[model samples]
Target: MKGKRVALLALFAAVLAAVAIEPAAAQSGADSTTEKLIWDLNNQLMYIAVPITVLVEAILFYTVWKFKNNESPLPTRENRRLEITWTVATAVILLFVGVASYQVLAEPYVTATGADAGVDTVAEDEEILDVQVTAQKYNWQFNYPEQGVTNANTLVLPTDRPVRLNVTSTDWLHAFHVPGMGLKTDAFPGQSNYLLTKPTDTGEYQLYCAEYCGVGHSQMLGTVEVRSQDEFQSWLAENGDSGGDTASGNETAGNETGALSP
Candidate 1:
């Protein structure tokens, strides 16, 4: 019994250690302001959660070990002081969580308020690019209204500039999610949702449809290419007016069926 108990405790400790380390290992290097904010919030919560989890589990295990062999267990007695202390502590923890989450969500780049607000929350001096995102069964269409450039399965953005994505769907519900940049917004038919992000790194990030739309949901994937301003402008000049003259005119005409290169 002693050996078994020791083994059980050791196993529990190992599990807790794995749980504590997994988040750090799984966290990707943040490449945008939104991502950084989310990561910071996660770390903040973990700082509170990890210690509480360990302490609670430790108390549970100790109580079980201490009382396991009690032949005549004493009647349970309620301690009002202990109960009140825990209640207050829990309230404080919840308050911290609520305030921290609100701070992130209230940011303009995090969650845009109002319908068709566009990039109104962005700083006056900052440059903003508008991209129209249309979602279909299993693919994505990106249209740069100002540049008159349309592309399928690939969203090209410039680094260090705010990009306002006006997202909507042509058919069913879908969600535009870019995990690396921490951008996600729902795409509803006949209604536009907006997301704002400024890419800090020049790289390719995976774009996924977070909401399951149909059987092809798993295949609904795209790429977000972040480039330097000069490179993006050159590419835009080359691709603009090649086809897809208007944002709504060529929804199904230009490369809409094209799949992202693996």
Candidate 2:
């Protein structure tokens, strides 16, 4: 009896340890809504599944130890109630997860746009900022069509406004992912992809080419600077409306400071 109790305690401890393990680190979101939804989904799924996993493992271990080395194994009778209980429980858990996933997918702020956002879209509303993204071998370029300014390596945007990035690749396939902003979109040659996000907080966030491309894969890193509306406008005025040459040029060799997106 003492040995059985010890075995049960060890099994329970093992289950608890498994449940306590933390998940992979996720990037902090730029907006409150996106951040809340992500954390809520993570917490809800863990709450629903952890207990079930613990219970199932505990029962299995207990049964294994209880029956081990028995001189005559007793005939087991099938229990209809046990079967029905597990089946219903599993269905209920899955149903809950499916509903939650749908809710996350339906959120407009996180979804990608299908069509290219134009000046008309921006003129209809000043709140929308359109930044065009072009991805190359190991670099990224950000162009403001409305402002008529182009930047290489660094992307600058205004906080408290919805920004749409129309992304395309010049060569090779790449994935544009900014973990901090909870944005990821694939960049294909000759095809454009769109990503939408609202920057609530003002700061520099890390951007990377999530897809493996070439020799400079690890060096493909960039920064996104989110500034206030007035500051952003001032920056546009300072940089002027001319779409200048990108960082790849020999003239701008020393100034090349950022990465590609999309």
Candidate 3:
């Protein structure tokens, strides 16, 4: 009576807990390879550990219950074949995990992304804009070396253009992440790495510092503005910016070749 009711309530609580826990676990960091690797390994460990733990517990309980003192000094059988079988099975499972992760490892480019294939595929006379992202203790800054532009809290990109993002940190480690373009990378001090991305639809993508650097880590965030080529050009001109090459090409960002009037 009461026990049955208690059991039902416990099952309901478990179901609610599982539902609440799973979505948060799924969305927290599965979006990045680094986080996914951690998650995948944890999942595998549990999958294997749970069954092995149960089996070992069952064996221990059975042995104690059934053969407390009757467990004789009988012949011990060494099962080399069983050991080899389990070893091979475990290896195969690990191999499967490695193979399954290929897609995640290749996401920033290699798939529907014309970045490595070359940005010209998206539009004529256009190349991907390369931006260097640097991190500090409490904030993020972006540099468009070619454009001779530097700014904080705001990243501007031409819509429909590929961006080759070279990332690094000026202080501790930080992660550059923009969800809309499905891009994220670590900004490690003294070490430079890059990622490729294209903004298909024009919009503002939120940027966050994924790595915990200090007290303000959780508060570090920025915005990336994706605009049309013309709008970008206008914006560049408004900011008096030029790709290191020289705005001598255009007064705005989109114009590849134009000279600033004296």
Identify the leading candidate in terms of lDDT. 1
Pick by lDDT: 2 or 3, better one: 2
- Model 3, range 122-162, lDDT digits (tens) per residue? 36766778887776655566777776677666788886666
Q: What's the TM for model 1?
A: 0.81
Number of clashes in every candidate structure?
0, 2, 11
**Candidate 1 or 2, higher lDDT?**
1
CA lDDT scores, all candidates in order: 0.80, 0.73, 0.63
lDDT of each residue in 27-84, candidate 1, tens digit only? 6667877887788788778767776776677667777988899989998799999999
Compute the lDDT for candidate 3.
Answer: 0.63
Stretches of model 1 off by over 4 angstroms after superposition: 1-27, 114-121, 243-262
Better of 1 and 3 by TM-score: 1
Candidate 2: give its CA RMSD in angstroms.
5.7
Which runs of model 2 end up more than 4 angstroms from their true locations?
A: 1-35, 68-71, 116-126, 241-262
Give the candidate number with the greatest TM-score: 1
RMSD of each: 5.7, 5.7, 10.9
Q: Please report the TM-score between candidate 3 and the true structure.
A: 0.51
**Shift in Å, residue 122, candidate 2:** 13
